[model samples]
Target: MSLVEAEIKPRKSLFVLKTAKTLFGELDALVADQPANSTAARAIVLAHMRETLVAARADAEAELLATSKGIRCAQNLCNAEDEIISAIHLFATKRVYPVDNPSEAETLAVSAVGGYGRGTLAPGSDIDLLFILPYKQTPWGEQVTEYILYMLWDLGQKVGHAVRSVDECLRMARSDMTVRTATLEARFLTGDKTLFDQMVMRFETEIMAKTGPEFIAAKMAERDERHKMMGNTRYVVEPNIKDGKGGLRDLNTLYWIGKYFYQLKTSQQLVGKGVLSAREYRQFQRAEEFLWAVRCNLHFLTGRAEEKLTFDLQPEMAERLGYAKRVGMLGVERFMKRYFLVAKDVGDLTRIFCTSLEFNHAKDMDLVGRVFAPFRRGKVKIKGDADFVIDSGRLNIAKPDVFTKNPVNLIKMFLVAGREELLFHPDAIKQITRSLRLIDSKLRNDPKANNYFLSILTAPQSVERMLRQMNESGVLGKFVPEFGKIVALMQFNMYHHYTVDEHLIRAVGVMAEIANGGLRKELPLTHELLPQAQ
Candidate 1:
């Protein structure tokens, strides 16, 4: 079974519902003795539930620390919160504001949205809820929502909520991409199932139908803007596990796309839909599990919803995750290396997913191609190579065995891409990755292969992008074994902001920018002497 499919044996200590029920029963007895609706009675209930929440969270954290099962901990915590909210809903309706015969407008359906709707809760993560009503707001509906919100707030939960009728939800989702995305993940938690089901039907027929392209474009743009804001790289020493490139947000983006376009309920469904192979799905699961584990550790260590893997928390996070000191690497260093490698895997999976979207015509080809397209100065002649073909202005292998037939094609592929100013088709990249074992010592030492590598490195056109692609695709590392060792190596120090391989690649990119006059104004001296050295 895949990691995601493995059942998590529930730990009784982490189950908050049992503890919550006992406390609620005690609070009910106390409230019965007090005057109805008295401030003192309300205080008694709030205090008891507050204590329940605190103890439940503490117990869950303790269990997580002991078992190191972060994914299960997240699910358990979410389940606990579900029980608490359900209990609140019952108390508000049955005890506080009893309605013998309710009108349709009085009905309310509570649904979890966003990350909460996805059935995971990191420590300190926001609890997002959507309250759906059958029609315009009734006094009872308002009262119920206000009561639930205030109760959750009093218990020290960070709750984000919206109360909307079904029509309002459809209208708002039509105008707002964020609302639409959240609604896509909406999972009914408690309340009128009929109302929630109606909203889902309308959302599918009225909003989601024939709008896959628009939603995909907006999401891709949003992701690009976020990546630009988050330093535009996944290799930063201190990375944001939630929003950084190749972080949880990237994984979430893939899931969002799959869900929006294909109506996939879970990422595993993507495999059955042929968007991802079984192996790729395994990669997805492993990366998701590791990233969540790290994010959970960060939240526990800081006692808040901390997302960044900062240096100060690195040691404790390493120790908590069971990383140990090795011959030359600290536990923290080892931990970070694993983090970067996982991040890279995320990037690869993203490329594969996006390419699948492109093939399905769900994603814009121009936008995807522009990401890896180098600056085009002038038209260049195309070299005749039967094994290669240009498709949609991107380089692609003519056959699957192009690389296996001749391992040197791995190095030559980059050369052709650099020379032609084209991006490798995602399938070609996938093929190259699968054929890395073909890059033996003989192929590495071959003069023709070395010459192709040298040509790519010294090319007058920007070599930075091609070299980076080679590194990411595993060609540079396998062909040049020295670079392989440092692929994700982290230097334990404050001065370095990136892993050794990333830092070196960035340095080369900077020099290329200076040589190409892209940064001449910023570094005139270096630009002036760049040619003199040549």
Candidate 2:
């Protein structure tokens, strides 16, 4: 009973149906006298299909211009792609299989998997497809799949496809996590629904049930590795919005985790269970919608599926997104800033979602959980009359107004974390985050709090790590308001290798290394002058 239950199927869409029918009638009239399976007949059908696809794309773009809702436009594009693929499947099946009556209960299943399967087609993105057989792959299935792929290629679509039996699919899903993840979002486009259903049933009952934790671990590791690969930072001059640390993939990861863990149909279901509040869900929707709009505009601008928001396109995209130059900032700067803000929202949502999963599903420390525990838990110590107590390496904040009551405690908690080389538990982090605003002008200039912050920053152990944790927890920005402006701030020139915030953090890390004599060989001059520098 979720709001989003079905794929954005073009066959079910009246606009697509009307468009396809009109084009098909023209194709039929042109090939009326030719043999059904003749080369000329096939060419006619292909041409008509291509023409219909082009027209549909134009309509979708027009819709985007009219409404500015990229989701709707993406769905429209998916629907058009579906209609084209479905038509091709039917056309080729008759020639190859020669069934007088084609019933979905009897043969192969043509499914759209991955991004395509999710029914959000970015312009010029690859059409990932699957041809599912009830049993083993046969000659007929092979021929049909080949014909469809070739025709799609002829129409200039970049296609990635696989032909697999139900058994092969299950085996692949079990063996390869990427394959499994892609298969999880597979949607039926044209062919045997029964076959697709059988695959879905077996995947859910047999594959998905036992593999949730394993899959989660693998996916989290994969995300960590990806973040490392993508500079281990969310802010970049030119970021890949689809795969960067806090990009669309992060958002998609949360949804995937929810779907696997809860067997939920739609993300809307997560709201009902308090996994995300109504406000958070609205933020989620806005971030997704904005990212999609930017992505769609990028595709249209570059005439391909261009995900990276390069410097050159920033101004154009900003203007297109209705942003104009302000007094000091250019249109492009404002646009990039907005993009980073969306990415930050994505980061916030990711933290909220992963925290929910940790409390709800992580009953015991699995291997992957242990690997990522640093991102969630902290050192255990119960001392003083603190409102919160640490039990079993987890910080439990017993009082909600702990920080509000004593603002200096903000720097104290981070000091304790830094001195002990412990991470801030999510609960502790959450409390601190909620009370960040309390560190106002007076508190920032507070002698005691400032001394505590400086001591933590200069701490011998894990100084850089603590600083980053402080920044991520929003403490650094609150303490030094000017620092907030440079966060995720990209320098347009090539001389600066990292974003402003990243460069600053790296500077601190390098200083920490030099202070500890860890960079003696790299900086002998600094090492010799270490005492004077100190």
Candidate 3:
């Protein structure tokens, strides 16, 4: 049975754990007996992993049957295996780091990105670490990152899995495996969350500011190297080439293609399915709005769009993108075991370049499946009023798992994270403050208005959030049906009930119907769809 075989996977880990130890011993003996470089090491670790997983499958099944517990049994076994196996790997990984030499970064923060960063590690998953790069902003960032990778390489020589650097993590992050496996499961193993968080901050401030320009340059830089290594503003991520296709990336053309096409593709797909109610479709429209806010790309050089690549593709395309059918989840281990394997990695990456690279045709290409799968899964509950809250702009949030490794998450916790520290940048908040004043300038003279404003001071992301809850429960619709005809589904919330995104759908109707003629235009909450109901 496969390691993922439900009956066997959970219980089988102890046997695998023992085998991993045995293999490490053999590798250690080999290394001790000869020069580390001269020792034949590749077969040693691979053999161990294969043996461990296979034996684990057999053993786990027997144990599960012997100690039959349903429901949480599988989950419990998986956790048990996770405990021992991770312990073993962690011990092995540390030994490779050496007690003798330590890194010199003024601040060293270790973060678990993707799954491990989020405190969820599977039985035999490789641990990911993003070294808080103290030197990234200075000239030292490059050197520091390089040195960190070298250390990881040396460590990898000694152990089955090596610690990956930020670059490696980000590169792999884009890989099919990272998406299916690590994105949801990552958690930090060491270092202060603050330091790791700072690294993200520096990366964003220094990097994303010029993302539009530097991204293009980074792509060009990679083209010289078979388009294997791609860069964003902060770090270089690897793009593995595919079979028979070598050097496939063309940044200039591809960037624009990704920017224009993904949103267009996703929008079209929503319509094509037409499964969602019109109200729900409008909610999806908000997602489309954010897609425009944050751009993602995987543009090719030149090729016609494929039928499989269409946003409206049937269920079969998942397999073409190297996934199971819709019901079949593409988990992280499956990705690492199947596609992110070195040969396939190189082959797939290169295929894009040789594709007579096509622009805006990647709908068939993203191995990650739907970009908003996490949001859709309700894995990360958006705290405030946003139907889907993203970590962008002045405001940000961190899912317990990913906050450490991601730059945006890191920064928010480090610099501006404090309740006291939430002060907006003087220059930046000026315009926003002025707008607030314009909207409520009369509040200064009205004590009641001032009191009411004070009441909602702590609830920045809540106004619309409550409205969303109401909308989801269909409460907004029930409370005010008369305005529904004019506003469709738009509704408002209490404080920001009729305005903003969350409640506006329900509130739009009221604003139009309640206010007579020109008077409707005066209130900031005046929208045809989501107007104030109460």
Compose the digit string of candidate 1's lDDT tens values, residues 1-534: 112543467646644455435545676787886763567877877887777677767877877887777777787777778878877777677667778998887899999999988888888899999999877657999888988899999888999999899999999999999999889888898879999999999998898876777787788889999999999999999999999999998988888888878887667899999878888888888888888789887887899999998888999999999999999999999999999999999999999888767755523434444432333322233568777887655688887888878888889989988987777676787788889899999998899999998898887475888888998988888888899999888887899999999999888888767766787678888877878898
Error of 2 at 130 (Å): 1.1
In model 1, what are the clashing residue pairs, if there are any?
none
Across 230-278, the per-residue lDDT of candidate 2 in tens digits comes to 8877778788888997788887888787788779888888898778877
Native-vs-model 3 lDDT? 0.31
Say which candidate scores most in lDDT.
1
Decoy 1 TM-score against native: 0.93
Q: Count backbone clashes in candidate 1.
A: 0
TM-score of each: 0.93, 0.89, 0.25
lDDT of 2 at 322: 77
> How much lDDT does each candidate structure score?
0.82, 0.76, 0.31
Expressed as tens digits, the lDDT of each residue in 1-534 for candidate 3 is: 011112224433322335334545655764454433232543443344444545553554343334432212233323333343433343234333333443444334444443234332222234454454443343333443343344334433211233344444444534443232332233333434555554444433443332323333333333444432222110011112211112112211232222222222222243343322344334333322211111111101011112111212312322322434223333222322221122222222222322212212223323333321111111233454222122322222433333222222221221232222232121222222122212222423355433433332233333233333323323333333442322221111123211122235334433333443334556545445444453
Q: At residue 526, give the lDDT of candidate 3.
A: 46
Q: What local lDDT does model 2 show for residue 366?
A: 54
- Judging by TM-score against the true structure, name the best candidate: 1
